[model samples]
Target: MLIREWMATDVLTVDENTSMMKALHLMKENKIRRLPVMSHGKLVGIISDRDLKEASPSKATTLDVHELYYLLAEIKIKEIMTKNPITIQPDETIERAAVVMLENKVSGLPVVNGKSELVGIVTQSDIFRAFVNITGIYRGGVQFAFSLDDRPGSIKEVADTVREHGGRIVSILSSTDMAVEGTRNVYIRIRNLPQEDLENLEKTLRQKFRVIYMVKDILKTV
Candidate 1:
């Protein structure tokens, strides 16, 4: 999916002149960790809770709570905001945004338009949601993990076995172990089938393939 499809709209931003104390207060009230900084209708920088903490007086200092608040109020977001922060375009695929965040060890990205204007934000949570949806992690289905010969039609046999037992395959994935004597691990998800039929299917699969694991469950959790 595209970044625009999952990115959060109505992102909150702070101006350079905004006080660090004000920014922290806004974040706390909204339960957000970061805020993009905007100036003259342009993206100027990005600030986060960590920035607020860093700008505060050190715990070793003898400043009282009121003194610390005053000191923080004097420090502007511009002083701590990351200038020219890295950004991704809204049209970029979710995978690209995820890769960028992972490579930079960052938790979120400011999504921009073709003109480099911030339109939304894609965070780690968005990426995870995309992954789960794409993998059918929320849809009720059966799951089986087993080893099979790394040869043609080996997967077909397993699939055929499930089909013979009136099971409908929803998705299947395989990982090959080239270092382990030409073996591959396969995982399959199927629509719910009767208990007796599922057992029979497992028994039949074990007759032809190495059955390492078998499980069934409702994919979604309330």
Candidate 2:
């Protein structure tokens, strides 16, 4: 999947000249965490509610509510926003976007086009949803993860092994590490398998491959 497919397009933004008070109000009214600051039709910075709280006058100061309000009104979005934030292109793969977010330790990323125009925003929740969809992890299917040779028939052998044990394969994925010799990590989703037969299958697999790891999930009758 791509970032554009899962991004939230209906974004709220504020002009650079907008007062900090107004920006905070907009965020509160919209129930959004961050606001993209724009200036002359270009993204200049980003502001979050945390920034507003941090910039507010502390109790140590003798300013009254009215004075605090006036002080906030005098400040601009550009003054407290994070400038030149890391951005992802709309066409970027979801995996790449997730990698960027993880490496940067950010909860969200502005999705921009080739011209650097913000089209939407991608959040960590979007990545998690995409991953769950792609992996079929929530379907109550038996999951198996183990190492296999990269040769063509290796996958067929794994499938056949599952079939021999009456396991219905749902999905399979090879690991991302391609340079690690002839071995590849494989994840397989299957139907239920009995404990004794599952152990037999594992013993058989261990006789063939290295049997790095194995797991069985029994279907619960509700």
* Cα lDDT, all candidates: 0.86, 0.82
Model 1, stretches more than 4 Å misplaced?
A: 146-157, 174-185, 210-212, 217-222
Clashing pairs in 1: none
lDDT of 1 by residue, 19-118 (tens): 9989999999999988999999899999988878877788799988888888888989999998988899988899999899889988988988989888
Candidate 1 yields a Cα-based lDDT of 0.86
True-structure lDDT of candidate 2: 0.82
List model 2 lDDT by residue over 1-222, tens digit each. 988889999998889889989998998898888888888878888887888889878879898889988999999888888998888899889999999989987878888888989899898899999987786756635677778877889888988987887777767878848535878888887655677877777778778765656755434652
Candidates in order, TM-scores: namely: 0.83, 0.79
- Which stretch of 10 consecutive residues in model 2 shows the poorest summed lDDT? 213-222
Quick one: best TM-score, which candidate? 1
